[model samples]
Target: MEKVQVSPSRTGSHDQSHNAKWGIAAGFSASLVGIGLARFAYTPLLPAIIDAGWFDASKAAYLGAANLAGYLLGALTGRVMAQRSSTAFTLRAMMLLASVAFFACAFPVSYLWFFVWRLLSGISGGALMVLAAPAVLAYVPPSKRGLSGGIIFMGVGVGIAASGTLVPLLLQQGLKQTWLGLGIISLVFTAIAWKGWPKQDAAPVHAVQHPRQSNNTTLKALYAEYALNAAGWVPHMIFLVAFIAHGLGQGLEVGAQYWVLFGIGATLGPLLAGVLADRVGFGLALRLSFILEGVCVCIPALGLGTPWLMASSVVVGAFVTGTVPLVLGRVQELLVHHPAQQNAAWRTATVGFALFQAVAAYGFSYLFSYSGGNYALLFLLGTGAIALALLIDIVASRSVDEAAPR
Candidate 1:
């Protein structure tokens, strides 16, 4: 079927129509595949490649950090420049950059060069992450916005699952060839997405107006919120695999297997959260996911080996990382009247979060070294941060409700 525009007049009817709902879901899912595979697949694959004796594990960790740093920079750039860029164009450009960057990783290069490729990939991946949901939201009607947002994020899970399945299968084909094949896959999908991208609508009229520069209190608070949450999550986010590799003293192959399990769990968490959000509300979904995140991180400490570890991995994957889009959804809801302002605000929040995450990555890596590569403490830290984030969300949601027009 050809792409159907969500006309202003037909917004209500189209929202209820099965075709519109599915189209939004399909588009979001496809974009997620592009974004997630390009950005996230590396975590699982790195260990496999390292175990194959292709590179040092420390270099892989640094490369991951470099990519995240690029992501922070890209989010800042996008928030400023992308407001005027067409959604279709932004999505296509990001995917193309990601595809080429990942493909670049396949050629043997020095550690410094590898970091450069990862950094470029990071920026491309970050741009995709920031743009994908907004593009998805533009196509969805306001009435269905929450549900659509949930479905769009479910794409993250699918991407995670794909990485899990793809890495192990490719490892059988040899490490270098596997990366080359993955790059080819990225390139092919980018082409397909470019061809199928929905046409951009006139920009949505959304922006919250602040009084002519009152102390920037609200903006400052939002930045603080993003920084706090990002700080809490960054340690595990950057070094989870490294923690696993060092803690268990497992070979790269063993680490890859666990990473695959983590991906599988991550995939399921979002879908379940989406369903719950549709039934309850966005705030409740986030809280539940956060609670599960704490449990998931702590459960692996029980020393149950592969099955228990896998179960914990899935639970961890499901809750911890998946709540990000829901957080963005809250930002959208907060600025329903000011689309541009809201977009800028969200971009700002993301940049703040990404920067904190980058800083945390380096700190946590050194901390892990100091602890003699103990991974348990990292999980402990993750659990505490997740608990705090959940509490903050609850408090923030209550404030939003109180402040909104009755």
Candidate 2:
């Protein structure tokens, strides 16, 4: 079969092109605000929050897990919301609520209040991810989806990079000021992006249906692989800074700087992943991502030099976060004829991702305590999980190949 490329002329509409551009920008900012300010900021602030007598070590870790749990809930709830409302409404609402959560934490609240705010912020990140990126892609031309997804997914890295750098610097001003600063930054952006969501004036909200197991084996394989990938990321996302700062005896400043390196990988990851997936097919790209991520996680575990650890950060960041949109892109391929099923698959994938992260967060925190803050061991375990996911992909592939001959 010969493939016909989709050109700009084939894409149709000067207005839709403009809208798609803005839609991507909105997703980028939404990602920046939702994940960068709301989620990643917590990492740089975690040590400070504990040092200030706000919470003990155990509670601090639990807080991280709680935020992840909220994100899981957001995914489940976002699915329900998608059936009832436009993506624009869901995206805007989540972003606004996330900003409010950030702002509320600026007050000298009780522990419960802080937890509530963190959870709300996490909820915003997950819901925005489910709604915002898909909305933008829906407006894009078919040929451009991969690159566009890569562009939009850069938000995770942007957020991570910004928080990794900004939060540590802000901590010099004290925790209260840091919280206020994060809140203000997120709120301002959400305000600007308030009405910017592109209106898909053509499609009705009810066009998409609930997910079906039309391809049960493929769905199961994707879910297992994705869930494992989610767990693989939690160690770094929640504890990498702490490991570098406290475990390595480098202090928070140095940790924050290296985190910026990790963010750099994250920033570059999706763009490469998307383009590569488009060229080579998503299955191979996914395998490559999982393999590299496994290697990246092991660099620090090797007790190598500082530069090696830093290099690993970038690699891990890129592969871990970058792999997301590629997987979603793969889901798009699997359901090319079933557009509604494709959308439902994306939502379900997010839920699976979040559910694993929430569980991994608490478990990793406990492992951190149980092993006496053995950061190296935790990273090693993450490496093993990545390997397992890779193996699952391999098994699924072989099974599919064997079935084809029958």
Candidate with maximal TM-score: 2
Error of 2 at 107 (Å): 3.2
TM-score of 2: 0.92
Model 1 alpha-carbon miss at residue 324, Å: 2.5
Residue-wise C-alpha lDDT for candidate 1, range 314-358, written one tens digit per residue: 676665446666566656555655555766677777888788777
**Candidate 2 local lDDT, 21-96, one digit each (tens):** 8877888889888876677778877777777888887788878887898888888887567658877788888888
What candidate 1 gets wrong by more than 4 Å, as runs, is 1-34, 79-85, 205-228, 231-246, 249-254, 301-308, 336-340, 391-406
Candidate 1 at residue 76, lDDT? 70
TM-scores, all candidates, are: 0.81, 0.92
**What is the RMSD of candidate 2?**
5.5
Candidate 1 Cα RMSD after full superposition onto the native fold (Å):
5.2
